[model samples]
Target: MTSLDLALIQDAYAKLRPVVHQTPLFSNRLLSQLTDCDLYLKAENLQITGSFKIRGALNKVSAVAQTNASGVVTGSSGNHGQAVAWAARFMHLTAQIVVPTTAPAAKVEAALSYGAQVEYCGTTSHERLERAQQIAKDTGMTFVPPYDDPLVMAGQGTIGLEILEQRPDVQTVLIPIGGGGLISGIATAIKSLRPDIRVIGVEPLGAPKAYQSRQAHARITLPSTDTIADGLKSLALGTQTYPIIERLVDDLVTVDDDEIRYAMGLLLTRQKLLTEPSGAATTAYALRRPAQIRGQKVVALISGGNIDVPTLCHQLNP
Candidate 1:
């Protein structure tokens, strides 16, 4: 289990300050009453790129600018692609983003909107990584992995900083896990600063790579994931992230698509928050498995809000 120093996370916050939003941390009394505890929402769904990925994307691309790299190549389900594309545009560099065929149309279009050259590949994390790595090698561009680098993880840790700053009494944090970068960074930052805090991870049951890996005490790759939470469908956690999760993270849980959808509806109607399935996953875990989080000051991290119109309509209507 590797640990990042507070200094590193603080540096990430400082670097990201000018570019990123110090997103609000809201406490919903309704959520607190339902869970029998004080509940806070880290509304990262309202982030600049509509997700927290921009923190890492900007951090990595800014570091890339110091070198003589030709451009940047990376892979994402959607939000990270847009974040990287926006970061590249911010630095006046070319960005080629390889996305899976399963990636949402809105996300691919969002990347294109940010001036990235979008390439459709196989619907798997491995496939996108291979393509992005090859592009970086052949084009002399820097390969910014979606969730497997120190700089990226450090950048993502900035959210943990904001959380503590906003609510120093935070007892537990429920963060959605995809490739584990977000959880890895959050756990690292929180544990380093306040080891008493509990860091729990939420993943869709359709894609329980992180949960399975933690149980097996080693990294495990899934054959496929059939979750609607596209942002939480990575086949496996990163090598860099797995150990940190195993070490620093308190627990990992999974929620089904129905649970996610129900939570999404609650977020929309009850909480008055717009969130995609992936963003709603943390709330789903707390709502579905309430016993674990009862009586604790919990923060549910809404990771993104880039829901497509059809899915949004379905979730809203259903």
Candidate 2:
């Protein structure tokens, strides 16, 4: 199995410096008061391609461009698909993205806008991945695994390096979990650099793969997932991501859709930032468990802001 380490993440940071944005780590006074902690938001929602997935996508695609493969194919709910499409375009390669039929129209359009051919598959990560792999096989294109590949994870880890540099006194970090890519990468970087700092992961209560997997002491694959955080509805943890998370993550927690919606509303109303449900998950946990993390310096990573207008209105009002 592939592994992630600090050195690999450092290399990714060096490689990405010319391309990726070092997004802000800014604090909101109201949020800090509410959570009773010095809370900062790692604003990857403002990153290029509108999410941190671009970091991994660009890093992976740049490496693949050195190969003889004609192009690249991958599956995503939305954010990663957009990143892959954008990266492929930047690298001057043809790209194909397989997304679930239920993926948001805005996200699909965003991917298409990057000039990648988009195909709709069944409404599940597994189905989309299978179809993407088939396409790659038939076309002799490289298959970009969203969260499982070491290059991708290392690329994502660059965020951790930025976080530590931005806030050396950070006591805890709350990251939203999907297939464990984001959390696994960040946890590896943080723990490798500052072993004393806590790295916590938050998941949607409806899709608690990482939380459940930790309890079961083995990877757990859900037959189905239902979550308002569509970007976080990964049915299983990545094989490569799970082991790193298991070893380095301090704790795994969960918040329901309602909490996520509340967090999104708060982010918009109070922080003046629009965050998707997946991005608001960690903030939701922090709000819900203020007593647990109070009196500490905490950073909540806002993973993305690619929400459609209707969903955004509903989340803000509901």
TM-score of each: 0.97, 0.98
Residue 212 displacement in candidate 2 (angstroms): 0.7
How high is the lDDT of residue 189 in model 1? 91
Task: Give per-residue CA lDDT, model 1, range 1-318, as digits (tens).
Answer: 424556777888999998799999887777778667788999999999899999989988998998967789998889999999999999999999999998888888889998999998998888998999999989899999898888888899999999999999999999999999999888989999899999999999999999899889999999988988999999999988898899999999899999888888888888788899999998888875477788988999999999888979987667
User: Which stretches in model 2 have alpha-carbon errors above 4 Å?
Assistant: none
State which candidate has the highest TM-score.
Answer: 2
Give candidate 1's TM-score: 0.97
lDDT of each: 0.90, 0.92
In candidate 2, the residue pairs with backbone N, CA or C atoms under 3 Å apart (3 or more residues apart, or in different chains) clash, namely none
Return the lDDT, model 2, position 49. 84
Best by lDDT: 2
Question: What lDDT, from 0 to 1, does candidate 2 have?
Answer: 0.92
Model 1 CA deviation exceeding 4 Å by range: 1-4, 316-318
TM-score of candidate 2 versus the correct structure, residues matched by position: 0.98
